[model samples]
Target: MARIDTNVKSIRYPVPCDEKLTLLARKLKRTKRQLFIEMVDYFYRSKKDPADMNDEMLKSDLSRIGNRLVGFFRTQESELLVPIHGMAQELVGNTETVKDELKSIHEKQGDAEKLLRENTKHASEQIRLLTSIFDGLAKMEEMRAGFRRIMEGYIAEREALGWSTSSGKKDELVRRFRLKVDRL
Candidate 1:
């Protein structure tokens, strides 16, 4: 069996006997045990050798880390943020130009549609006029045919009655009718 010291029986360690550790605990207004625990925890968490660290060395190391962080942030701003900001501005400009062109195209399309409607209306009117003109010509041709049929009937009756087909009075009357028809 192993023999354990009286102090080590409960805490598993002997109390420190350093004069500086005692003075530092007094100055820091903490118990010697608390100070020792805090020092051990700090060295363990920081992964730094307590024998190699002092106030000046810690400050220099912190300053170097701060400078490296600042330099990294600056590089990121130049490489990524600057180009992204420029692309955003260019996208805004291009969008405005495209919107203006689309608006112009829409206006031109509206004007073309209006012109097409007007042309269609005009064509319809012309078709109506042409239809009326053709109807008038057909009615005139019918009247001319009826007048010829009546004249032929009259000539046939006179010929069957053994009357002369041409006479001076008839020729004068025909000449007067031709003049009236020409005037009409």
Candidate 2:
């Protein structure tokens, strides 16, 4: 085995450690004296030389550190209401614009479905009319699927933040939103 060098002499403590220190020493698998020596050495070494640190490097380090900290916090078992609140704040701000666009989509979907139904019922004798009706139906289905996707995304985001739709209020809101979209 290689020999380790010790430049400093060990000092003895006259009294026993307090409960916290004793527990810490046991947890760390080291005597209190050894821990103290290591800490003293670390402090002396840190004070001996100052590393060349710059703002850009410090910022990059902080960004990485912040990312790790956020990731760890996100893994913890906790209520997501706070995070959902932030998301709701963001989405709520854009609600008016989204609602306007949804209204236009709803109107277009309604028109397509109505045209398909009318053409299918009254123009069966014309092949071109039949084809157009089928095409309109397909388009309406696509639009409905798109609307469903949008709702799914909203619900998924909310769920990820720990919001459940089991409540009567949330269920009613979901039903109303879907009804409004389907009415188009």
Candidate 3:
């Protein structure tokens, strides 16, 4: 009796005598079963009729797909890439403007700080000069007070002794004045 193999099943299909299917399978480095499965899947996925796919039809289909890809790229470039490029340029320009403004502000700040320092220095010098002038004036006032007091004391002493404080002769006063003027 012949043994039955439970793990295998078989079906038969007819083909032309030229063996084109076998040749295509060998050229594509796939088994006949794998080739048939792939072909069936491709037809199902693409929804294309194999009977309509001659060389000219294939070329026309590829050209149409190529034109669609080109259009999609052009749309994306116009809608996305071109605007992004313009925005990038505008951003760079804004950055440069901000930098220039910052630099100008920094320079102005430095100048203002320098001017404040110079003004402070000038104010301090003026304060010192005023202080010196006030000190000199205070000393001169003290000296004038002292001289007035001494002159009053001398006049009182001379009056108590019944003598004239300004008893110098006219000739003596004139000689004294002439001597002082000569010294000057």
Candidate 4:
């Protein structure tokens, strides 16, 4: 024979409450009325402001957090030491020095990179300036060559016309031809 749950009374709700009642009753491993009694008791206790209770709750929470942190560090310490256990003690002793040296090397490498960039910028500017100078020289050479060609052509034409190449006549011809060629 099954036991009967007697002495039940009706409970009312503004909204659907059957699901919540079933869940709470199942979780507490009790009848619906027992769960209701506990709920009512908690509701009256919670009528006090929670802000005051939170301070105490926060302290407990922090104490639990600290315990967890200590446990975490203990586990991590064992894990970290496992890999290094086989290494020679000499290397372990020098580990801090090696770390310092590596840090210094990294700092020097950064400085060297900055210096290299500065030097490269200076080199690029110098190359540009040199290129400009070379271009100017090339233009001047082209102009000089053009003037020589004009003089040579005038001499050839004058000689073909059976003209004299006397010193005084040569000077006068050069002066007149050069002035005419310069404008063009």
Candidate 5:
């Protein structure tokens, strides 16, 4: 039972037996104010209330616990302390080892991530180069086809004007077309 309220109302009372209270307070090494507080707490605690069964049971249980209580620290060199201390030290060592392993793993992961990024960049560059090369080859093929069509048109017009479509004339036409393409 504790009262911790700061906003206490002032109380003043005259006790009928002042000499006895003063003597008792002196013998108990308490101030008159403290004696008053103790008297109030005792009076309320000893007051019988049929509704408060929990307090009676708590008192009975608390008395039993007090009677059975033992103190291990009352003796020197306890048997439990050495094993507990050894276990704690072993756990500390294991924790340090785990920390070291975790640090190594973290470093390796960083290196692996860096390597992956570099590989990705290199792969992307290679893909870009390959794509450009393919595009140039495709454009060259298309230009060759266009040139062939233009040469056919020229040969057809020459044939309509009575020029021979013999192998000799075909060789001449091919040579001229190649010369023109090389110049361009």
Candidate 6:
């Protein structure tokens, strides 16, 4: 049992003066008034009553209280410099390394993207040339069919007119007609 301080005037009652308060004071190494103020602060931070709290809500409240208790113990036991300084330096180094690696990857990706765009443009130009060649071939076939029809018609008309089939006149007539068609 520890002696209560006499100079403390702000001590609130219903302050558990039992085994719990005694254990808490020994654990915190704080006076009863200081522990009370800590408890009040914790309560203020944790109080949030749901409109319809159930057993799950009660469990959540208990978990928060347990967390506050552990935090208080950790604060009491914490060192001022060693863990904080060491962890901060380690985190800073890790972040810089990660940033550098990401920048390197981004540069590589940008180069790959540029290459892909150039390849795509080359493929599109090749496709356009192929399409134009096919269109020209189709037009040439149409012209060949039209020329064959005209030659067959002229041969039929000469046979019907009783012209000499073996004469060079037929060749001359075909040449003159072809030149006229070309001009048209």
Model 4: weakest 10-residue lDDT segment is 46-55
Model 3: per-residue Cα lDDT over 34-146, one tens digit each = 88889999988877778774656568899999999999999999999999999999999999999999999999999999999999999999999999999999988976776
TM-score of 5: 0.51
Tens digit of per-residue lDDT, candidate 5, span 22-63: 899999999977998887887578774546767786698788
Relative to the true structure, candidate 6 has a C-alpha RMSD (angstroms) of 18.9
TM-score of candidate 2 to 2 decimals: 0.24
In terms of lDDT, the poorest run of 10 residues in model 6 is 48-57
Residue 94 of model 1 has an lDDT of: 100
Query: Which RMSD values do the candidates have, in order?
Result: 9.0, 38.8, 8.2, 15.2, 13.7, 18.9
Against the reference, the lDDT scores of all candidates come to 0.80, 0.75, 0.79, 0.80, 0.79, 0.79
Q: Model 2, stretches more than 4 Å misplaced?
A: 1-8, 17-21, 46-184
Tens digits of per-residue lDDT, candidate 1, 1-184, equal 9987655523444445567777899999999788988998997887776666565667889999999999999999999999999999999999999999999999999999999999999999999999999999998897787667656765665566454646875665567556645644
Better of 3 and 4 by TM-score: 3
Model 2 clash pairs are: 110-184
- Tens-place lDDT per residue, model 6, 1-184, is 9999877565454645556877898898998668877877865676744344664667877999999998987785576556777899999999999999999999999999999999999999999999999999998887787777777877776776565566677777778768855853
Which residue pairs collide, candidate 3?
A: none
TM-score of each: 0.55, 0.24, 0.51, 0.40, 0.51, 0.47
In model 6, the runs with Cα more than 4 Å from the true position are 1-81, 163-172, 180-184
TM-score quality measure for candidate 1: 0.55
Error of 4 at 173 (Å): 4.3
